[model samples]
Target: MSNIIIGTAGHIDHGKTALIKALNGFEGDSTNEEKQRGITIDLSFSNLTKGQQNIAFIDVPGHEKLVKNMIAGAFGFDYVMIVVSAAEGIKPQTVEHLEIINLLGLKEIIVVITKKDLVTLEQLEEKKEQLLMFLDTFDFEIKFIHEVSIYEKESIEKLKNSLFSINNSIKQEENFFRYYVDRVFSPKGIGTVVTGTILGKKIELNEKIFICDSQMESKIKNIQVHNINALEANISNRAALNLQGVNINQIKRGDLITKKGHIRGFDGIDISFKCLKDKKLHHNQTYTLFIGAKKVEVKVLLFDCITTLETGYATLKADEKLYCIFGEKIILRNANDTICGGKVLNPIIDPMKKNQKRRLLEALDNSDFTAAYKELLDAHKKGLGIISSTQRFALSHERAIEFANELENVFVDVKELVIYPMETKDFIKDFIKIIYTKNTYALLSNASINLRLKWASTAFIQSALDELVNEDFLTRDVSLYKNSNIKEDFTKELETVFLHRLKQEDITPTAPYNIYDDLDIDRKLGDDILKSLTAKKQVIRLQHNLFIHFESLNKIVKEMKNIIKEDGFIDISNFKTRFDLSRKYLITYLDYLDNYSNIKKVENRRVFV
Candidate 1:
């Protein structure tokens, strides 16, 4: 193995020191207090070579006072060396360490028992059996066992050969360049420098490195692996670097360095908290949040008009503002309840809620463009719309113009970033539903952005609409579009009612049945007719209670002539009495006629214009 991290686990004075010396042929305890007090205080380091494979060893403290130090030491290793002394059987630190390992999500393990020579062969076997029982419960198993005292000058090769069988054969990953800084110092000749385990990928000399979390940048002057000048370091290998352009004071542990603006730090996010099965919480509770190398203080509050936090349900609120992006992992805690927490649903978000809907719309419009492109296929399934490439850039978060080139070729599409699939079938159904109900055709421009759907953004709605039009599921009339496959039929009875009412007085009916004696339908259908007429512009919609067929006033006037032909004027009361209609209705009809100057209103009475 080119680079594989292996760490040791056991309580204080469990022969961790002697075991490392026996396996690696060296002493790792470096601090003066450790050598004087005869116990590991902080973290210690060593190297184990098994045949052609080499593995680095991290030995952490096991005393109760130094548990936090142990956590910091083992936080990033991929494998563990679980040391159980044959004489002692099992210890509290061993179980606590196991819990920590589980919480960190680690699965790889190598179990070892030390000081086996002190016990009888039978006793050693019994102790091994007991450790195995505990191991079985924890899902960890030992691959090798050696019975030798710290004074043993033999069995080193046997232990080394066993390690060879288990060490990973594959070389380190060289794709994602990430290094967790564990040591920082200045050499006699070199100014500011840092060292870390180059996890996942190697780096090129003189490459521009940026501290994303800190927003700092520098040029790499040199690289060293295992104290040798190296062109590059592979993932899982220890590396030291000389950085040339930044002040040492600004560089600190927990500061992640990468390409500038490549990793985004978000302030607030939408998260789901797993309420403990029985614990109830009130809003605005404070907590300490631990994620990766950073620990932040969080303020938890219930979401959207609710105050009490009940079990089994999740709510939204900012416990703290943490900068992050999609797929980033987060944990929330009530500082009082150390291990109780939740994960963020949306890792990147704005902290403010004032005008949240508007902010959401703007963010979603941009988010659609920057999100992975696979989501486009989903959006295509539903439909598509138009968004400026600028919006796509905004959605890219900290990646900048990198995704802009990828998004330029497509026109109105159900689009997503490179990863998420967009769903469009429901959108098309809704599109058809609206058109079917309104009895109207929509241009692509209007259909692309129906105000009814409330799709986070106009751009997103249009994206879906345009996709539907292009796929031929719907037809576009230049700037407009509508569903082409749809055909709605009215019953003959309904058609006759509509046509006769329109033909009755040679004008469109304000509404069919209300003006026609022969026309009739169910109450629902009557409502449909009125709505359809308004959409068709067959009748104009005015103030709340008024509607008029174009010829109703005309027909009324012809009838009025015989009774009032010689009159100088007409009274509103007299007109309503003669028309046999409510005064409000008659007055509204008269007002409509007056607007056309068919009659003049002179102080509550009307005369011919």
Candidate 2:
């Protein structure tokens, strides 16, 4: 079922409460003080269900002193019900309330002229004309108008039917779960219960959420929709959640409940502001800022201009941290009057430098949120560090990845939950330069590349090198990287020199140190050439610094196989005597034969497999 939150807006003694009582059969003023004073001083809630729709009424205080409370309660309303007494006509608060409703961007309204029986028909017609004229100054159109006497039963029933017939025009989208705490109290046997209108998404039973102000966590024990027990509550509906792990005294109005770590509180923000009154907003002037269901003191710092009549950019330094985001509406008031209101441009931090402010304002002026995010990326692209998804974008890990994938930029995933943009062309150019300068068969170590490109991260350098290797531009050999496009002529020459020296020593090959020293070659280069020879089957590596010709290794393997077959098994001492070799060479040759599956070692003997 869809829900429509209809809030009452008008001056004191304007019959707002009486009008709700006539339609719902209950007075919205629940406190004795309101009844004694004959005026509402706080917010009250009631509901009426008809067919598949639920209509929740929020009655706000009509007095001037309680306008802050009215602003707090007006956040989640879908429509405004402006009630004017026909006998009293339009008053000061009537205009103020209308201004507030307009500032909230509510388009639907139902104008109800109450106490019709107290005035003559001519006086009532005059009041209706005056009300229509006053409404013409605003942008929203009234959907329906009714003149009713609550004393008459037929009149009450007709108003109720008309209200129920109003269609819900707003389309709700699936979003993250977030609910503003408007009313908090401790009910007997229920622990602590918090009531508010759900804005973005549904909240389920037993789900853990956090208080955005204090970062305190709690779990939902139960959910109620329109006073009926429910396991979950839908968006745009009035819901009361029974909570555990948090005390009633710890929570207050304007505290937000959302997924843990999804929101952050900040003491400074940037906004696009517009002055509603004729007064000028001076620099460093303090004002009460009403945002969502919270009110805080903020000092305004105007940019590029002195006064704000039309929309302009400004920074607000709040006395305390406020949990807000971009695109939220803000209402600013001085000591006595409502001066201005606007949309929040950015939260979580303030613009420190002049160029940063200019760029941010330009991005907001000419583009949407996607462009603004790209601008933020551009600022960090010059620096060599990664950007944090939570700090920069104000999003969770999963959501930030999704958002980044949707943009035109490419991000390189790194450790510590950070991401850096991959400048593909620049990195590939630098990598190719490093490989081309080496111009040798021997591969280069990662430490050498790191010394040349000190600005890039080790992970980024490794990733770029891997990309080159994957594209067949480079080949790797155990911590060494070589350019694949380099000619193999030098490697073949070195291999010829190494193999010829090994063959000169017959079955007992020359050690690697003697070959490199006699050939007048670098030791590391000699190792590389020997490894290449072993890979090509031209030489067999027996042990560290020992090499044997492949033909000699084959001869030794054939003799070992013949001996193992004839004797069933070959003992270590007997094998050393048969080969006419020392214990070290015999052991090395026998182990090599065993590794190639020519023989299997059992205890101290070798057996043919």
Best by the TM-score measure: 2
Q: TM-score of each candidate?
A: 0.55, 0.71
How much is the lDDT of residue 22 in candidate 2? Answer: 76
lDDT per residue as tens, model 2, 179-295: 889989998878999999887668899999888887898899999997899989887788999988788888888888887865677898787777765656777778889988888
* Per-residue lDDT of model 1, residues 1-609, tens digit only: 456777778877788777888776667677788889888887666676645566777788888666555665565566877888878978978876775665454567777777877788899899888877877876554555565566655655666666667656233342246565655677687888877666545688988887665577788899987677988866666677888876777776645555554445555555444444455556666655554444566566555434666532232334433444332234444533324344434444433344543333334434543443434333333333223221222233224334533554433323342221234434545754465345432222443244344433455555556666676766654454445664444343454456455546442234443442123223344455656766766545444534444355466656555445656666676675676766665656556556645677778767776
Worst 10-residue stretch by lDDT in candidate 2?
Answer: 382-391
Error (Å) of candidate 1 at residue 150 is 2.9
Prediction 2 TM-score vs. true? 0.71
Per-residue lDDT value at 586 in model 2:
78
The alpha-carbon RMSD values of the candidates against the true structure, listed in the order shown, are 16.2, 11.9
User: Model 1, residue 555: what's the lDDT?
Assistant: 69
Error of 2 at 291 (Å): 1.1
Candidate 1 local distance difference test against the native: 0.57
